[model samples]
Target: MTILSYADSALSLLPPVVAIMMAIVTRRVLLSLGMGILLGAVLINDFSVIASGQYLGEQVAGLFWDDGAVNAWNMYLLGFLVLLGMITSLITVSGAASAFADWARNYIKCKRDAKLLTMFLGCVIFIDDYFNSLVVGSVARPLTDRYYVSRSKLAYILDSTAAPICVISPVSSWGAYIIALIGGILTAHGFTDSGHLSVFIQMIPMNFYAIFALLLLLCVIFWDLNVGPMRQHELNAQKGNLYDEAKGLPPGANSDLPEAKNGKILGLFLPIIVLVLATFYFMVSSGGDVLAADGKPFSILGAFEHTDVASSLFFGALVGFIATLALVLIQGLDKLYLTKGLVAGARSMLPAIYILLFAWTIAGVIGQLETGKYMASLASGNIPFALLPAVLFVLAGLTAFSTGTSWGTFGIMLPIAADMAMGTHTNMMLPMLAAVLAGAVFGDHCSPISDTTILSSTGANCHHIDHVITQLPYALIVAGISLGGYIVLGFTESLMAGLATCSILFVISILVLKFKSTQAIS
Candidate 1:
């Protein structure tokens, strides 16, 4: 098959649009993604049935096997999901989760405390979005459930905090990846005065959407700002219903698992602590290996830049699984019950795994179609200097939303934004780059197909579509505020002005929600 270019054409946009629309309308994610994948294959192969079939086969095969070997990244991620499911199941069956909830009830008195604790944990677990999304829910769910905090609300907090914190934290995987990209972009654009790390630090304040999203989540928790679909979820939670049971149990929840009467709280925290430590250890050690192979002295940042995240996560989860099993054995659980827990745990993760595989496959198909390239091309033309940052923000958001990957959006748009800024808005490079980062995160928050989004739902044990629908309004509000900030920054050429605008708008939005809640109460 010959390589074709959809880089310059709008046809590249069709697949994701069709997929997103179908997903929203029919609520069938796998089917929608499959349709999009097939459409992309047909279009990419110029409507040849044989070519399309072969291309689709190769794409799916390539996800698992690359260059005649296993695709370590995808396989490792799948492995981690399975291990996490088992850990969750083991924790529940061992009665660790129940004990922890009981222990927490002493310190956490109300629903507000439960939600705030969830948000706090979300911020604390900031190393990797996947880790944060999966771990925080497992830790906080019991407490939240004790207070009847809706599963959708928990999912929202997990989703909001996961990527936003990772994007801003210099020590996180997201930060390392973005900084590496920024380093290349800066070099390419003849910028040598500032280190990528310093530039990343400077851009933090300009990452308006990320900062605002976290703030919005805080306000939602503090002031009870459950607007849109989330309000219904909250009301139901207050009525002692965490979710619509008719929709069935969410992933990672196994009702068949038996709980031990004498389960210790240590059973819960021990494995989680081990998982976090082991993952961090593996990440750094793996990075050290890469640095040694390159003949470079080991540095924290250098190691992060070269770390094998997938392998690190898999090994960490594997270690955590061992810890969970040991705890169960320590409690004198029989082998039969242990086997039952393992089977139930693995069974619960199958739905999420299926959705994830299809999401990855469709993302690959969209990449082949050059969807991001087409979107980026639309913004390459001349634009008013005052609108450049805003344009880049919107463009980056659109790319990420359509393709469902923030990192992919960064790869496709960061260089373009860097070049455009250096060429036109020379002094506004940092703000422009920050806009791209903010936009990518904003888009990821709203994208139902995003891996982090799926994981958040799984971790919270919330229905995926319920999470998507309930979270959309909150994401949009912050996005709107961030867009306004970017537009102001572009026009005024002042970061402070933009920051002030966002801060004031956020406060006002919270107040408005408060007023509305008060009126509803009356």
Candidate 2:
């Protein structure tokens, strides 16, 4: 049974706002989320503590073993995390990591080459954000470290490319989820003969945030566009200090792994290559007839449309773990050493698992309070249709930023944007839809409490808050540009004109960064 709803009042915003503030202040996502959950419980009991303690107990316990948001899929994700930890630990101990670093030294001669290769690898792994963020960061960090690239910058590249690429790629898990969401909405609203694939494809042109974000990453890479806290991090990195003095080496750094004396690069490459290929295969196969509404055979796009990301990724990781172990055994390493590496790898992912639980708990509490519904109703009052796209963009961004979940933001905003535009007899359907997508991603990019942010930090071995601070400036630049684009599209109703604004602003920003860097150097 759904509880904690407050009939679209200001109170629905309290839990998330408190959570966001507490996260930034304490820099402890778990504690902040717990406080938010307690606050939600109190609010549900009409701001009384008579039974709030008991209710909070149930809610917290429910996060682990409940049949709600933190159910089977959550377990699959947890399993994937542990499995991934094992793989990384294996690579570290198996000597593959050092070997790859040596191999990368020849090809990646300078900072630019290292950063660009990181970017290239990130873009290439568009299957899923979790996969992309983890794989790219792990593979590139050792290479990047040699050139004095900051962990914060590496995290930014990982985070930026992960969600943005997945959001835009039609064959990706993100796209599949979006397509399914859009498909359901389309069916409910009486639209026929049009598949979500075509709609997603058409929506691409107006996905200004995702497009410009990738472009912004290029500017940062090619032009060394360091701004805000990122610049200090970069400078400190050049001096061989990758983190702020206050935050020392993380407790679970991979330094615990016993380095092999004769590790081969292929030991690392073979397992990752297997995971990537197997994930794609399982994704297509897992969807089966779920992609077809009428019991028909699954087409290529149809398979992607119905793919189960958690299942496929878990399968890929399991296979990858086994492959990595086998490779280690064949390398003539002590069996005990291999066993230790696997256990250590799995153990290393515990922090991420705890964070994921808290994230899901808050998401659950937000759902119970109907927070997204309350947020959406803010746009329900009479408004000018011409400015709807811009309004929706800001509102959608706020929702995603508060919730720290882009998919949740999409579910709430997309339907409202669609119905609102159709009801008002406006021609902004495509733009409004695109705005929902753009704002969700932009907000997710900026949100410190976001899963992708946590995963990015985990991947790059950077302090979580460091990653959040360093990346925020870049996310805001794209957001500001996206908001302007939406406003222009609102007025002109021309996608080309609006998109042109994004391109122009990005180029100008790159030029400004270049000038800034040149001046600083001299």
Candidate 3:
């Protein structure tokens, strides 16, 4: 088969799985992604070489410099990584993180409560997943640690809430991406009468994966139902078997550190509030549009035309840094100490920043090789109409898992799913799209190289590997339930029925958990 034919044939399943296995075994995410991209590019190039009698190097160069490659590199992933570094750097330098940590430590006394609060905060800040991951992890890790909540658990909660919440919320960066993808599919299918924003609003409820994941996260928090690997980790943690089991030196060690006290805890709150409010103001002012106003009805979309993940984080982080500085100076903090605190915070985030860059580069390479599109095309031919939602969910999951990015997965899946829905004459668009978001989140939640996963580990002061191991079970359970829900909804086309079934299952699960807890207590 030709390269395009093979890529259109089987690159998705084989290459991504190969990449993931390589990453896990080598423990080098970037290397694995690089290999995956190389394999994909080689497959395409070799096929062309065999068919056209061209040199492999020439074909590879042409493919790499294609418009698609340039767009993938310059537009989506590169800018996103730079913005991630800047925002994360600002968060650390401002001493806003320390302030938030101290305040949460003083107020939240229980491990479960701390986890729940983190989840709630994640829901509230649905504008950007990168912002959500960095802010929530930075602020909540300290509080969660004091209560003996495992670092793994904290990472899980943070990962669970970040992308899943934002993708469903109309005000977030994920929302805008979905709308754009959906608009393209809609226009292609002669559904231009329905505005992109309007269609997104209508689809929110049908997104089974996002809805179920949030609900399940709440269950884990309030109900304390730790099944599968999460349960084992929790048991081991309680038994003092977790990594670095020894209780470190006194808690005051951190407190007494000059850098820790550089800024009052309240200082962190101010910048976060400003960033959040600014995001909301812009989102609403633009009518969830990505463009600036120009007297056109859709002028709002123009405002966000230049808005990428990096741009949003840049503005928010800048405001946060200024707020942190002003608050520290006003409180008569020593200038040296303040600078030291900021430096400390930045140092703390270094690991996460490295992980983010690697994750982005990997995703970029996958796009360059067209791995995801190949996978999507392969599945399109064989998918049964009744199984469309499940197929989409799985495809989205694999894409995010391989790429270590939920946003990229959604960008790849939404348009294809929408087009499939129209072609099949099935009303499965909303549910399928929801599955895309949910599946992407599930994979990103567990993938060790994921930015949110790294941030969750950083926030919780947990080892990154520990977080990935413990968080996997919880993510899978939610995915299992979401798959079932999507299947039901796909057949019935009844959103209400699907929700009811999920609710009943959730309630039963809670009851079972409570009974099991009572038995253990007895």
Query: In order, what lDDT does every prediction score?
Result: 0.90, 0.84, 0.64
Q: Per-prediction TM-score, please?
A: 0.98, 0.95, 0.79
- Give the range of the ten consecutive residues with the poorest summed lDDT in model 1: 247-256
Off by over 4 Å in 2: 68-70, 289-294
Candidate 3 on 394-441: residue-level lDDT in tens? Answer: 888877776677777777787888778878854676777777777787
For model 2, the run of ten residues with the poorest summed lDDT: 247-256
Model 1 residue 70 distance off true place after TM-score fit, in angstroms: 0.5
**What does each candidate score in C-alpha RMSD?**
1.2, 2.2, 5.6
Q: Write the per-residue lDDT of candidate 1 for residues 309-352, one digit (tens) a residue.
A: 99999999999999999889989976777788898889999889
Q: Which regions of candidate 1 deviate over 4 angstroms?
A: none
Candidates in descending lDDT order: 1, 2, 3
Tens digits of per-residue lDDT for model 2, 1-522: 225566478898898899888877887767888888888888887766867766667766775577545655777877888888888888888889889989988888889999999999999999989899888877887788888899999999999999999988888888988888888877777777776789889999899999999989987898788988899999999999876656654312465578787899999899999989988888898787575555878776778877788888899999988898889889988777787887778777777777777877777777878887887888888788878998898888888887888999998999999899789754677689889999989888887668888888888878777788789989998898888888888888999989988778877777887888888888
Superposed on all Cα atoms, model 3 deviates from the true structure by an RMSD in Å of: 5.6
Error of 2 at 237 (Å): 1.3
